[model samples]
Target: MAGTIALPLEEFIASLDNASLPKILQVCSGVYFQGSVYEISGSEVCFSTGDLIKVIRIELLSVSCEDVRKNDKFELPINHTGLFKVVPDEMPYSSIEELLSLRPVGLESSLPFTFSSHSKMTFGTLTLGPGRALTVLSIERHKGEEDQVRCHVKGQQEASAEVRIPLSSRGEFYECGSEECFTLQEIMSSPSLRSRRFHFINTTKYEQPLVLSPVYQVHAIMNLRKNVLKFPSNLEVDVVDVTEQCKDADFVNPLSLTEVLSQPDESFPAVVEILECPETRSLFKCSWLPELNKNQHLVFHKKGTTAMVLLSSLKSRKTQQYFLVSQQYGGRLRRRPREFNSVYELYAASTRTPGLKVSVTRNCEEVEEEGLPALSVGDQLEIVSCTRMELLCESSKGNKQSVEALLCQHLSDPNDVDDDDDDDDDGDEEVKEQDEKTEVLLPLYMQGHFVEILSDNKKYRLSDLEKEFSLPLDVKVVSRDTGLELDPLVGAACLRIEASMLEPTIQASFPHRPDYCFEIPTQWLSLSVSFTKHPLPWPQGQPPKCNIERVTEVTDVFFYEFRIRGNTDEAPPPRPPKRDLSSLSVTKKSSKSEKKSSKTSKAKNKQKSVPTDQFSALTLNNKKRPPAPPPPDGLNDEPPPLAPRKLSEAETATRKAQPNTYVKMEQSIKNDLYDMSADVDSDHDYESMDESLVSMVKTAQEHIVFY
Candidate 1:
């Protein structure tokens, strides 16, 4: 065999110097130099061959995610596609290029609105965007335009109730930068939505196809940020699936394919494209459809500017767009260098050697990390991701027995090590064999674990935050400690997740011990529960009650643990499912039934000891039981078992069949996890501490998923 071979899982892992890959991808060249308005002031940017710059590109790799829509008072108009995606008629839906940036000339509202120099404006979503508050959209001034535009406005939330209008009827707003734009001053003064819609006119011209969310759409508008001409070298995605868009990427035989095509060949030579990989500069004849016209759309994203720039080559010229690159900073013109030497140092460094692996990770689950409320088993955690993770375990052909043995390790009773990386060496061995020689191992992070809300000063935690999320998660402290208050972390947890990370080697049977606190400081206000599955939908009109129970389990090994914090005065509130428009999103809510359907039962069958309930009656045996229906969204727990409000015969039919409709639209993709059992635990009654932890792990499993 001439091809490379994969080593056994143990041997591969053991051979590594470091188990983890690098966080930063290869340093790149062709940096799009940036000019700052305030920071650089009079400075200028100049690009030179071989020069280097750092950039950050924000990339989202998810195929789908859940969004919630809260109905103000009515149920039908609940805006469930997520406020971010809603581009009301007031502001037409736009790409980041057109919706949210502002220019430095300062709001010269006096000038007439005309196309001239690149015009930048600010776009802030009124309580709708996903980021803290808003986003800024800017328009690059076209070559022949003149005039500054000013926008006075009202806040960007729903117009007053008077604006009684369905989004579809309203259509899209004009794509004018200011004619239909808003300013902080104006936004705060807009009229009622009902009156606004009723009085406002409707036009059919702007109706464009409702497209799926763009791969990268600026979510919110924050501040009057200038545009960035460059992009960071890497676009982050926790997982990726770049399965060669071409049939024979490396086998570029133009003549061979052309000859076949001329003589009745099936290779479809017309589809072959001679294109360059932006990251890897080598020419690749890919399988991309010729109609894509990717080459014409010259877009470059640089780190400094939190926006993507159009590297539009002058249309007048025949060369590829951006055939020549330049740099500019702060308005002052940096003199261009005389020599056109090769910019190959960093460029060549980015080229990949065979077998090299590079990738990025992100936390997409609604699960909590720090202030998330701890979860008990019986809770289902569904973490969906589009990451393409590879299993480097030994091949069944050669190490079938060893692979089985390795899997068994996860099931063994707790063999706890003191620190979080107790098995660092062991795990590293597997990674060593897997990662490439030059791969940078970015820091590995854990996301989506549930945690009890400690306090609620609103932590809009995006490891990398922007202005859109700039909702004043501001601070206001009335500290009793008077003197030594740190960053005044509002919803700060007294005990952090990292603290227990590598806690002293937990003894056997306590791998997932629960750390309980009976009483806590009153400073923590919002006792919000966070889910790695869905933004917790705990019922409202109630506080929380700590119902701590400990149980022993059959398995001696430990898996995970949670620290529960609760208030005795509060009672567990009722939970209602949040609505999601299935046509647009996969509803987040599924029932926690007292019974199991054939499918849930099939998955449940593996757990021989699970307690059965009314749902079990529906569980079918073999013969491909009609695919069990999916659970319903917006479902209320059969309204308090006792004196439950009975449903009418018609209402009952609607409830039962709705879920099956949803399941047809969505399918969960399974990731080959190292310890599949740990993420899933049964919420069975336990005898002691060991059982409680085991059960927690099992419950955690429902939420656990590998990306």
Candidate 2:
């Protein structure tokens, strides 16, 4: 400390070379420009006196040129290719040795450099007149002889001669401007040349002599600050080299997660302080994320890159969620049937899985004009292919239009097994008839509820499914990961495989839970920490076998972002064509025609008898009262008198068997209402009432009379 000197911050920084680093400097004076704090790059820098700064690195940014006469300053890049000539010093030298010592470069490199003398000089039979120039070509030395400079001289009539001058020769020698040139880099590289004045070779623009100085971007760390500070060396502050005195000074060196990856392996298994907390708390749903606070201590177990698969919860009316599952997940997955709300969705699913079979969840009415066949609840449909179909009914303009439709086969229920072996030939003929009648055409514009019918019950591993099936496949987690303290996917009903990615993460944990580690994805989360000297929580040579958290919850935004980055799937199927509602026309029948049709239907019903068996096949039986017959053809066109509606034998027999079944009248009314609602064609038919509803009303009246 006694031999240390306090130099201006700029001078001390310029004198430093990378090989001699890293030097510690004490701020002898505060940085002030016009009595105010100096700022660089929007950071207010006010280093207090006595503050210690460890100068870790210095980078040569550019060369600063200052005009001596005008006091003007500007900067030139270190790679500037312009040439410059050294300006001669106004003061004279006393000896040849003194003149050679002041050369910008080494004496050998400055050979053939010309100079002149103000007075005449006689050197042992050699005479040099005033204002005569001599070029020192080289230096010569002999045994037991003083060093001498070999000079090349030219006089009147272009006559030239060579001579040697002793090193100790004395005269009023002055340095003369030379025709030789040097670049900005060459001048700045030489320690002695940096102090000399130079002028541009092309004097047209920069005629004035300029003094060149090196400007360095100093990279240092203040003891109070956690991050490294970068500032130019031309600050108006003074510093002293205190590295030797404060050799034990401790500085907090904070490094980002990305920077930590570059550290040596020995740096791990050590405690570290969190300097900057992670800013992306919303991206990850983890308990440790909130605990990652500033100044919190965590033990970094190790770092590694892990293969992860991104799973997303099936999107519904609720918010869609995402999860990151490590490839090491031990849980088993079972394929879950996907649900569709429209024919277009079913078509899209068929593209991914051929021979896709689905069951109707809601009944759909037939639209003959639009080529939409009727669909009843519990009906199974096997999507065969896409084709064009012509509607059964023509448009209002009497023209038939072809539309795109899905061709599907209606599979009969398995419960409808036949037991008639004696009539096998008849049953075979009936089966063929049913097959031909089962082909249905569904237009893409129709909306219906359907659910996928999955037949495979085999369980598959998460990784196996990801490899075997293309993503966006739905699955349910049948088993939970035992390693995790809380697995979010354990009870999830359905999850979709969004994508797979290889993530580089840092395995870290809290000091209290050194053996329980959570990964910090270096690419996703931004954090900064300082490795501490604190000993590991565990004993030496006995590191804890950390249990890493493999599953983490992420937001839908992360899923969409990942999709954007890595999505390579083909474009989605083209949208279905819009339906033209204006083209559909419904024909209204006249009163006379409606009456004739009603009579004909009633007569046909009378010809068939209802089965008396109690165990009858279950079917969608929708019974409606027949409309009153219109006036006879020759009778007056007057409204008919209201009369009691006639009932079929099935209804009569049911009533007789349950004469005291009035207690069940309410339940029978409910059943009748449900059956009527299920009739798709009865949506607009208000004239007809279910026969059971009428019977329930009559039975209630009769019970009132008896009571």
Candidate 3:
């Protein structure tokens, strides 16, 4: 402090420039007007005596103009384009050397400047009266001769002459007003001119003389604070340049995560403090996110690339879920059997997994006229292909119709194996026996319960399963990750591999739990931290082997973001063909007409009609019924009228006792046909009407009375 020069804060900052920046200043005295606190830009500023401030940056804000006459001050932009003329100095100079030395610019650049003499002086033949003006044109120098200034003198009647004056010549010289003009920027940029006073050229509005000074916004940091402090340099405090004395001063410098990546290699593998916590609680749903807090320390392990995959849990009515998956998944998954409710679903599954085998879950009664095959619960069927088949029943006009059907082989139960002696049979003979199995045609419109039959019990890795099967494939985890303390997928009954992705991430962890690391996807999460001198948690040259968390729980937002990025290449499956409502209505009408005819025929001859029990076992492959022989007279044939008969009292009582039961049976049959038709109509396309056979048989029985 003995040798250092202390100046007002403004003057010290004004003496410095950008090239000599990053200066450290010690506040020698504090300025307080009524109070010690000052608010600037929403931040409190209180500078105490001996406070050390490290000034990192200085920016020109505006030019402060003070009216010298009235002591009034105002601000003007640094880019002001208005010109100002130099005001003459009232004080007179005693010698020519003093006048030239006091100029704002070099003598060579300040040529042709006017100055008037206060008293007449004679230089040989030249004579000047009081208040006569002379302009200095140039400087003259001869060999071994003293330097002199070339002066221009104007005589009477617009005549002018030049004369040389010695540099050491003594005279009472006064600066005269000149026509030269300068902008505010030009005056502020020159140190010598900055000290001079000026006034606006337009005197009508601004008649007062002004003294211009620069205002600077200083960006400084205090030794006791963690954030940089910014304030204007016009404060009334005084400071001294102590940068040389405080060479070891430390200032807080925080870096963002993006900036951390720019740090050198040797800077990594070091400890760091979180000056500002990241707002990632909502962005990433993970177990470790809550651990990130301000002032918490982390071990910034070396940066590298990591390949990751995204797995999602099956969306259910309970909750939809997502995950940030990695290739390090250690669990095993087994394929889960899928269930089907209709033949359409079966066809859809067979297209993906050819040669699919399924077992019927419910019994289906056969309808021969409609081509529906009988299927018993637990019956096994192997789907071969889709084909067209002709129905046993004919149209009203006696024409046959073909419909789409699934060709399948009804497999026999394994428990009912042939005798052991058949094992020695030739391969050809065995093939022939296998081919003898019954083949059934399932109509596309038929609705029945069925489930996939999974025979293979092999386990598969998640990555391998994704490559081998198409998603959304259903699977159950057979084994849990032994490395993880708590595995989310452990107790899940079933999970669907909704989608997969390959991502690049940064592996990071806290210093307390260095061995347990979580990946920070460089493309997703945003965070910032600064390296500290704190030592590593482990010994020098040896870092503990970390167990990285491969799977991370995420929200549906992550899934939506993945979709928005257009990462998937699979197009949507084509929609099913639209059903023809007109054809369906026509089929309903034809069935109604057929029902009427069957009822009339049954009423005419009940003994000749087959019983309902006999029709239940009929199959689509059965021989078609021969057409009834044409009437004896094809043109006109009438049946004889029935003879009325009287009933006995016992017979009449029996009919009255069973009337409710008979009517209930008829209503049940009608409801069943209506339900079957409703299920078929709900589908996108109806390829066949195989359930009509049961409706025809039930209708014929409605005509028969109990007695």
- Please name the candidate that would achieve the greatest lDDT relative to the true structure: 2
lDDT agreement of model 3 with the native: 0.76
| Model 3 TM-score, 2 decimals | 0.46
**1 or 3: which has the higher lDDT?**
3
Per-prediction TM-score: 0.12, 0.51, 0.46
Predicted model with the maximum TM-score: 2
- Residue by residue across 1-707, what tens digits does model 2's lDDT show? 33267889888888888888888898877557756466788866668788898888899999999999999999999999899999999999999999999998888977779888889988789898999999999999999999999999998899999989899989899998988788988887888988889999876888899999999998888888876678999888888888888888888877889988888887777788887788877788777889999889999887888889888887677677789889888888899888899888888889878889999999988866566678899998999999987754333355566777889998877655555665587876688569635888888777899998988888998889878876668899898878888888987768987677889888998888788988888988888889888888887888878788989888766777777787678655444444454442222345567889999998666534332111122112424434433332334565433334557899887764433434444555446555655667854443334565456445544444221
Clash tally, candidates in order = 102, 0, 0
**Residue 150 miss distance in model 1 (angstroms):** 16
**Model 2: residues with Cα > 4 Å off, grouped in runs:** 1-45, 49-220, 228-253, 264-267, 315-320, 365-374, 383-410, 420-422, 425-447, 567-573, 576-707
**Model 3: clashing residue pairs?**
none
Which tens-of-lDDT digit does each residue in 39-149 have in candidate 3? Answer: 989988878888889897899888888887888999889888788877778889988889989987778977779987788877889887878888999988899999899
Candidate order by lDDT, decreasing, is 2, 3, 1
lDDT of 2 at 86: 91
Q: Note each model's CA RMSD in angstroms.
A: 41.9, 19.5, 19.8
List the global CA lDDT of all models.
0.23, 0.80, 0.76
